[model samples]
Each structure stands twice: as C-alpha cells, then as structure tokens.
Target chain A: MELSLATRTVAEHTVLEVGGEVDVYTAPRLRERLVELVDAGARNVIVDLAGVEFLDSTGLGVLVGAMKRLRVANGTFGLVCSKEPLLKIFRITALDQVFPIYSSVEAATGDGTGSGPTS
Target chain B: MATVRLSFSPAPVHVRTARLVGVAVARRAGVAEELLDEVRLAIGEACTRAVALHNQYGLADLVTVEMSDSDSYAVRVIDHAPLEASVGLTKLPPDELADESLTDDALTTGVGFALLAGFVDDLVVRPVEDGSGTEVRMVWPVQRR
Candidate 1:
C-alpha cells in the first residue's frame, strides 16, 4: 500500500507522522524523510506511527537506521506507536528496548529530550 | 481445517496483499486478535525478503504464499530467488552473516528474517526441492498464548 507522510515541529522536535503499510515498497519514503530530517539537523525526532496499519521488518529497518543516524548526531530518537501489531513487531525484534516509544505525539514531544544535542 | 493459497509476482506491491491474506487466513482459523498481527508480520517479512532477493539477483519469478489451518496455523512463503552467491543465507554462522545479508538498499528487508525467527513459534527456511528458490515456513498455534 502507498504511504502518507506529514511532518511538523513540536517542542523543537521534528515529528514525522506516517500512515499506511510500511513494507519494502513504501519504507523508502520513510527512510528518505528521516534522512532529510537528520541532515537538516533535527536531532530530537519522534516518528509517529500511530496511523501505521502494519510494520514489517523493512519498516523496522528504516527505524533502526534512522535511530542510528540520530545517535551518531548525539540526539535522541523516539517513536509514537500504540498499534498492537506494530508493538508486537517491535517487541519481537527486541527493538522496543532500543527506542524510547511513547503512546502519543504529545507525550513524545514532552519526552524532555528536546532537539539537537543535549548535555 | 481450511487452506488458503495465494500467488503473485515477486514484487513489492504484492507483499502487503499477501500479508492481508495471511491475516485473514489466521483470523478465519480462530487465531486471536493479538496473534493475527504476528501472522501478518511473518508473512509480510517473508514476502519482502523473497521479493528483494528475486529483484537483487536479477531473477524473474513468482512468490507463492500458502496458509493451512489445521490444529495450528501454518504459513509458507515460497520464492524463486536464487541463493545469494556471496552470502548464501540459507543457514550461516552468526558471525558470518551480516544481519541476514542486509548489505545494500534492496536487501534492507533483511531484518524481516530476524523478526520472523523471533516471533513465530516454529520458523524454518529451506531450499525449494526443485532447486529453484527458497521457502520460509512459520507456524502459530491455535492455542492462544
């Protein structure tokens, strides 16, 4: 399925909102968005996956790659995901521990990480 | 005791459709709502890998998905993707495999194999008997966890 993307800045965090099935076909869009955000210096980022119908390994890979990119920039990466399917996949891959996942974007913005680098 | 079989081109577009069919099959087999996600992910990952492998290896093939509902739900995704020459990811030592050969762009779906192995109860990858492709097999029991 095709993916839809929306982005906004909240509390200095770049919130990338995505909806649709994120698999091999559509994950590139997500990856590119994350790359662009990172290149543009949005360190503290929240990937709002609340609207995601399904997330496979491909999507998970994109998240991992994005998180790694952010980490290199010394920024925190978080996720906003409540869907059972996405949660199950994240847990299955043991990625839940790797990412700071929140239930909502508001909570994600208030995560206190802020944007850019933090001391 | 029902079986659902689906086949499509080994393309990215068909991956989601195949996954939906897998979820439906599990739902019809009395699989719990929670477990349905597992089925959907396993199927999607397998299809993604198969499609990526076929495309990367420059092979034109078809992907076949089979779901059987008996005492448990068994799903299989078959692809005619040639064995990756360098990696030959059929079964490699942990150190030798780079996250299931998730090297370049197309192979990004490499994480799918790991997710399937960890989530599904019993998962296996075998070479097609005809020596043409690979088969990813996974099963979820009817008994809820």
Candidate 2:
C-alpha cells in the first residue's frame, strides 16, 4: 500500500501523520519527510502512526534514525501509536523502552513537557 | 494444509509484494489479526534479506518465498548466494543481544535477526541440500499464543 503523509505544526512541535503500510516500498517517503523537517529546523516532533496499518523494520529504521538526528540537535521526538501491530515491532526490537509511546496525538503533544526527541 | 510459493526479482520494490502474498495465505489459513501482523513483518524481513543477499553476491536469479499452512504456519526465504558469501546475519549470540537495544545505526547497518527470533515461534537456518544457497526458515503455531 502507498503511504500518505500529512504534516502540520502544533505549537513548536511538528506533527507528521502517516497513513497506509510502511514497508520497504514506502519507507523512503517517510524518511525523506523526517529529514526535511530536521533540515527546516523543526524540533519537538511527534509522529502520529494511528492511521498506519503496517510497519516493518525499514520503517522502524527510519524512525530510529530520525530520533538520533533530533537527539543530536537537542530536540524532542515521540510516537503516537496504540495499534498492537505497530506496538509489537517496538517490543520486538526493544525500542518500546527507548521511545515514549503515547496513545493519541492529543496526549503526545498535550504534555508540553519538552523532554526533547528520544524515540 | 495449504502452501503458496512465489519467486520474484531480488529488488526492494518486490519485498512488499512478497509480504502481501504471504499475509494473504496466512489470512486464509485463519491467522488471527495480531498474529497476521507478525506474519507480514516476518515475511518482509525474510524477503528483504534474501533480496539483499542476491544483490550483494551478484546473483541474477530470483529469490523464492514459500508459505505453508500445515500443523503450523511457516515461511522459507531462499537466497541463492554461496556459503562463502554468507553475511552470517543469523549468527548473533543471544548474550550479545540480551542487553542491547535497537539503535538507528545498528538497524541501518545490516540485517536484523532479533526481530525474526522475537516475532516468530521458531527460526531455523540451513544451507540448501544441493549446496546452492541458504534457506532461512521460520514458523509459528496455528493457534494463537
């Protein structure tokens, strides 16, 4: 399936809402978007994966890379996902511990705690 | 028991195709929703590895994926690379991974066997009987865990 992306600004945080299956074919689109945000000096990013149906290692790799990039820039990053399928991948790679997962976008950006991007 | 066999060019674009075929078979086999997700990721990883191996080793032949529904669900990703070309992706020791967690650089570096081990019930790696290549086999019980 094709991955559709929608981006908007929430306060200072950039919210990238991704839909469709994230796999080998569609991961690069997400990767490029993340890079673009970093290049644009956007910090405090929250990836809303609520609409994503499938995510594989390729997609996970992109998220991890984005996290590292944001971390280097002293930014904040987290995920908004509750789907069991996506959650299962985090558990498999033990990334669940690394990234703070929020149940919803409202919960994720609502915190405003500003811990900086870590996921 | 039912089985679906697919062979395709070892390219990244075809990886999703492989996953789709495998997931379709598993769904028909009555794999639960949660478990079906695992099946999708597992097949994607397997096909991805096989395709990468073939490209790295300069093998022009197709990569084969076999999904079977016997007593248990199983997927076999066959890569036609020679033994000498082995990347040894499945050789990571358990202890090496016990304390280690996923890192972006690590995931970008190479293949991931941990996901395979953690997501599936069983994983078996063996050389093809005719010494042509390697078969990465993984299985999960039909009943939900």
CA RMSD of each candidate after superposition: 4.7, 4.1
Looking at model 1, the pairs that clash are: none
Could you tell me which 10 consecutive residues in candidate 1 chain A have the lowest summed lDDT?
A110-119
- Alpha carbon lDDT at B111, candidate 1: 50
> Candidates' lDDT values, in order?
0.75, 0.78
DockQ, structure candidate 2: 0.39
For every model shown, what is its TM-score relative to the native structure? 0.80, 0.84
Clashing pairs in 2: A75-A117, A76-A116, A76-A117, A77-A117
Model 2 / residue B110 / CA error / Å? 6.8
lDDT of 1 at A97: 59
Judging by lDDT against the true structure, name the best candidate. 2
